[model samples]
Target chain A: DVKVTQSSRYLVKRTGEKVFLECVQDMDHENMFWYRQDPGLGLRLIYFSYDVKMKEKGDIPEGYSVSREKKERFSLILESASTNQTSMYLCASIPSGLVTTYIYFGEGSWLTVV
Target chain B: AQSVAQPEDQVNVAEGNPLTVKCTYSVSGNPYLFWYVQYPNRGLQFLLKYITGDNLVKGSYGFEAEFNKSQTSFHLKKPSALVSDSALYFCAVRPQSGGYNKLIFGAGTRLAVHP
Candidate 1:
């Protein structure tokens, strides 16, 4: 089975602290994405990467940044963690070649900012 | 802008009864619609998708959705509800025009199954 793993399951950080949430997928997929989940908003894409060292901004990319240094690893960064940034972060990936309907997701990382 | 809508914020149903979660989408060009379910404190799980062909798409966990082009609706349905089926459901749309992974999601609907 394809697996997407988020390294950090839970974290607590002070305001203004730099934070990192790492995700790794074994699917060798070219398309990877980072999304934030809130109570009412569902999942909002923060950023996505088509390949290593390539990134694209999504709808809510203002407070977040991402890195795709390697194909299997995609990292989401909060330069300065804030209270509003406290939410469940999800990592997903899909094969770009075919008209595949599946997008595998990581378990999720819950970040709490104080 | 392309978007999807889940009209209900929450739906309540008793065990052994049928249940439905409503969804409608508005987008340019052909739309690829999908349904997902998220258990508490977990990532969203793909339930079903409608790419082409059949309007009735069966998916994981005994869930199915019907794609209605005329109404632009893809409503998820299940014959019998179970207590374990209570979860947060989301409706999403992928535009066929551009951006292969650009998925626009709706404000989810919470399903509650009472035993």
Candidate 2:
């Protein structure tokens, strides 16, 4: 079984603070993604990394950045967390670039910015 | 633009009754469709997927989905609904031709099963 681990499942941060959410996949998946899920809006991709040091912006990438220094770990960084940034963050990974490949997701990190 | 649509925001059914969560998508060429379930405060769990071959795909937790090419639909279904089956269901799509493609997800539907 594949396991995607998120460093934190629950977090509370103040406005204008820097936040980091981390994810690590047990398998060697080439593609990793970060997404913020909100009610009605659904899951909007923040960033995705295809390989180490390679990143791409997704639908909503403002105020967010990603780091993929290693194959197993992917991190999402918020420069200045705002109240609106409070949402559930999900990390996902697929084994390869195959279009038919299904993704595995971490438990998710719920960020609360006050 | 490629998109996945789940018409119903919520579906309610009694336990032991059959349940279906509708999902339709619009994308170019043949697309890969998937169904996922998200429990409260958890990430999405892959339920099933339709790539090719069979239209009916069975997945985890006794769930299944049917792929209809003509209708561009891949609706998730379950033969017997259980109270534990209640969760937020999402439908996703990925176009077969795109290079380094990203998955698109629907807004999601909430299922409520009562005994």
Candidate 3:
């Protein structure tokens, strides 16, 4: 069984404050992704890391950045949180090489920027 | 640019009856399709996928999906619907030949099961 864990279930931050959401996957997958979920808008990709110390911006990476310091850990950072940045953040990881690799997701972190 | 379309916003079904959530897709090359389910406040879970060779695929929690190439549809189905099966379902597709296989997801369809 694959396990993906998030650092926090809920978080609240003031405007312009820095925020970090952590995700760890036990399956040793090489691909990790960060997305923000909003009603009607669906889940939009924020960033993804294909390998350690490597990161790429996704569709909605304007206010977000990601770090993949190690294989098992991926971190999403909000340099300055804003009201519009409040959303449910999700972390996913997938194995490398396998073309049909399945992406596993964490429980998700609900962040509110006030 | 690969994309998926889930036409229905919501589908209602009675318990013990068959249910379906429609999904259609468009891609340049052979499509790698996937189905995922999301419970309230929960992250999306992989249900099933269609890579090749199989049209009917079975997945977790008594869920199944059929890939129809001619129709470009991969509708999720259940023989006997359960109340616990109600959730938001998303369909995604990626181009098989694309170097960066970034999945494009549909808006999603909400399933409601009544006892």
Model 1, stretches more than 4 Å misplaced?
Answer: none
Candidate 1 lDDT (Cα, whole model)? 0.92
Write the residue-wise lDDT of candidate 1 on B54-101 in tens digits. 999999999999999999999999999999999999999988878855
In the range A17-110, model 1's lDDT, one tens digit per residue, is: 9999999999899999999999888889999999999999998998788999999999999999999999999999998866547688899999
Query: Which ranges of candidate 2 are over 4 A from the true structure?
Result: B99-101
Total colliding residue pairs, candidate 3: 0
- Residue-level lDDT tens digits of model 3 in B40-95: 98899999988998799998899999999989999999999999999999998877
> lDDT tens string, model 2, A1-114?
999999899999999999999999999999999999999877889999999999999999999999999999999999999999999999999877466778899999999999
Candidate 2: residue pairs that collide:
none
Cα RMSD for candidates in order:
0.9, 1.1, 1.3
After TM-score superposition, what is the CA distance of residue B113 in candidate 3 from its true location, in Å?
Answer: 0.4
Models sorted by lDDT, best on top = 2, 1, 3
Error of 1 at B34 (Å): 0.9
Error of 3 at A93 (Å): 0.5
Collision count for each candidate, in order: 0, 0, 0
Native contacts conserved, per model: 0.60, 0.68, 0.50
Q: State the displacement of the C-alpha of residue B28, model 3, in Å, after optimal TM-score superposition.
A: 1.1
